[model samples]
Target: MITTLLVANRGEIARRIFRTARAMGLATVAVYSDADADAPHVREADQAVRLGPAAARESYLNVEAVLAAARATGADAIHPGYGFLSENAAFAEVVTAEGLTWVGPPPAAIRAMGLKDAAKALMIAAGVPVTPGYHGESQDPAHLAREAGSIGYPILIKAVAGGGGKGMRKVERPADFTEALGAAKREAAAAFGDDRVLLETYVARPRHIEVQVFGDAHGQVVHLFERDCSLQRRHQKVIEEAPAPGMSDEVRQAVCAAAVRAARAVDYVGAGTVEFIADASAGLRADRIWFMEMNTRLQVEHPVTEAVTGQDLVEWQLRVAGGEPLPLTQDEITLNGWAMEARLYAENPAAGFLPSIGELEHFVLPESVRVDTGVEAGGAVSPHYDPMIAKLIAHGPSRRVAAHRLAAACAQVQVWPVRTNAGFLARCLEDADFLQGEVDTGFIAARLDALAGALAPSDQVLAAAAQGLLSQTPVPAAEPQGPWSALTGFRINGPRQGQVRLYRDGQAVTAPLVDGPLSADVLLNQAGAIVVFEAGEAFAFTGSPPQAITGEGPAGDGVVIAPMPGKVVAVAVSAGDKVLKGQTLVTLEAMKMEHALTAAFEGVVETISVAAGDQVSEGVVLARLTPSA
Candidate 1:
């Protein structure tokens, strides 16, 4: 029996696992880096240990440090939540070798499916349907280009190791193959420490469906249905739902059976996901679906499955790892209500979805829905981890009702200076195409313009802001237009109407306020200049004073600055180098993702301030460029 459980991860997943472990009367330990000393997970655990510095390699990903922490904490088992070393075969092997139970599938199963190339071969040998691709050992760029030609145009280049859409690129033509290959390798190497890549035919109009499968030490395996992660942006899942829309019983049965077979083939134990890609051009069909890959750990979107199946997956993992059989037989398992989960990220949809870093000054979500989050109000969102702030899940008897509740919850998210993708997610849930279940992997990309459009502050929203700024309460409708109605410096008895200056998106606009005091509910968060008002949808406004700039040059001429807190991964140019517009000046790796900084216009490089390995904070100048002489 496991008495003490140490979670070998951090953030929301760590808190999630602890909730289950503590409920089961087990002592829980949390490991955190220097950056997360005060993180919620640290306080949530019975014991907390410092791993190392903020860099993942020296901390969370350092297997020796993790094992040492478990031993120090007297933990009998280590739960490698998701990400980090969750699917690392070596980590699992080391934990078991140390005589501590590893709360995951065996190391052999992880190794069997760790590499995409090897996993595909194993799947083919097991008679599981596989996508046609080049999974060869030779990673020669020229050879891979030739294979892409053989596989036909519009092929997908995927890193042989790792997941989460890193190191993956879509090549639309032969001309772009080489550059794409170089980029794919760099990202793959940085993310997974592997540069090898494989090619496959890009499934047009594809739907990403994955089945939840579980197994036991006693060789029992069963599936708990599938989730549709079709709505995606830049290959990352944005929203997910269970009992995929438009799924037929025939296709569901076939996919679930295949998932169980895949699990049993690996002698899989605990929770794992078998992902499949289906061609939705002809709607849901059993034969059109092909195996994608398997996630050998719990998924980020597991709450939707839990909501629909009425099961706690973490509890099952603990039970299975403790020498127990499968908790429920396949015949006894059944799906109930329809459920949906929307991931709220600390990012700006209007600003290329670049991750934002700051304190959650005024974070608040609707109490009506299930919100799983690691940070609270006033908590910091560090650049050292994923930008996801929380996940909002909703369940109902029907898909329409679930979608409606989830959409409402999205709009109710109130955050401050650090912008969020709540508005973008709200738009996705309310879009007609998504509501009708006409979504695919390309759904967000195709409708990005509409989805990321800035919402102009409505009249009511303006009034609420005015009320909060003026420090006025709701007045009766019968009240006549009085002298104190407007916000302005008054001269003697002034008129009731006047213009109020409000800044939004850095532009100051005059909102005309008429009559007496505004009659609307308004809330002002003292931490920042924010005003919140809840009607059919919740809307919040951050007031900013207009800025005056003296320069009349190009918008990005002066200096190239780091957009967010990150490390300088590569510097492509040096001082005195002449560069054309759109030339890449440097590459910055932030949040384990690479972002290229480009020359805004034709210019001459004046100075390079940072080196390849230097860590930088937001707005730090990396290089300066002057106009051509």
Candidate 2:
């Protein structure tokens, strides 16, 4: 019997596991780094221990520190709630070797599905169909080139030890194969410490479908249906739904059966996911869906599966880890309703989806949906981790209703200073094609322009903001359009109608201020900045605008700046290089992901401020550009 459980991860996932552990009458412990001292998960745990500094290697990823924390807290069980070391086989081995219960699959199972090449071979031997690709142990570029030719043009180079969108690239022609392979290998080495790659035939119209399966030490394994995660941007999943739209009964049965078989072949235990890539040209046929890979841990989108199936998967994991039999047989598991989850990231979609990190001065998620978040009103989003703010999940009787509710909830998100992808997610959920279930893996990329467009402040919203600013600062008496017209000479008895000009995102707009209180959507931050909320987006405006001499005047500058603190991986351009707008100039790695800073305008590089491997801070100018001669 497990009396104390320690979650070896952070953020919302750790809190989620603690909730389940509490329900089972078990003490919960949380381990946090220096950067997470005041984090919600740390405060929520029954006992918390300090790991180390902010860097993951010195903290979360340090096996010794994690084990020491567990020892100090007297935790008999460890639940790695995805990411970090959740799928690390060696970590699992160490935990069990120390006489502590590992709330996950056997280490052998993790190793079996750890590398893409080995997992593909294992799945083939388990009678599960896999995508046509090369899974051999050859690093020769010429050999992989030959294999790519055999697979035909438009092949996908995937890092054998990678997940998410990193260490992956698509080659459309033979000429681009070498470069793409090298790039993929470099990223693979950086992310997974393995530069080995596997090739696959790129599915023409692909849909991502994965089955949630659970197994026990008693040789019992059952699947909890499937989730469709076709909506993605830059190969990262943004939204996921249960009971994949357009999935027929036959297809679900075939995939789930294969998933169970795959688990049995590896003697898997606890929560695992079997992912498949389906060619949607024919609308989700059993024969067209091919095995992708298996996740040897709980997934980020598990809430959707739990909602649709009406099961507490964490309870199942705890029971299985305690040497219990499967909670329910496959026949008893039933899919009830349609559910969807949207990952709200701290990023500005209008600004190349650049990650934003700052204090969450005022954060409010909709009460209408199930919100899983790690930060609260005063918490800050650090640059040392993933930028996801929260996850909003909604369930309904049908897919359309679920989408509607989810979209509404996303639009209702209230966050300031730190930008969020909520507005972008809401637009995606309300897209007509998305509503009709006519989506594929490329759905988000195709509609990114229409969905991520900047939220322009309407006339009413602008007026409300002006009113808010006027109410704070006494109304001016003369020179209605002067620089201090909105701030000088108080007029307590004059006509309430006063015009004030405010600048937002470097664009100047004038609106008439009225009497009475400011609108509900208008807010005043600590710095006295007027912020207007619309469709889950916060637009800050100021009465005093900066001089319009920088870059494109009234719209910021032509200097390329780092969005967050990161290590510069490469400098693609030097001083005096004539570059086109949107050309990649520098690439940096931060939060375990890569970001390529591009030229903001067609110009000649005037100066390079940073070099390769140099660490930079947020808002630091990386390179300066002047108009082309």
TM-score of each: 0.91, 0.93
How well is each residue in 256-339 modelled by candidate 2, as lDDT tens digits? 999999999899999999999999998999899899999999999999999999999999999999999998999999999899
lDDT of 2 at 195: 93
> Which candidate achieves the best TM-score against the true structure?
2
Local error of candidate 1 at residue 71 (angstroms): 1.6
Query: What does candidate 1's lDDT look like per residue over 264-375, in tens digits?
Result: 8888999999999999999989888888899999999999999999999999999999999988999989999899999999988877788988987777888888999988
lDDT of 2: 0.89
Candidate number achieving the greatest lDDT relative to the actual structure? 2
For each candidate, the alpha-carbon lDDT, in order, equals 0.86, 0.89
Which consecutive 10 residues in model 1 have the weakest lDDT in total? 472-481
Q: What would the TM-score be for candidate 2 when compared with the true structure?
A: 0.93
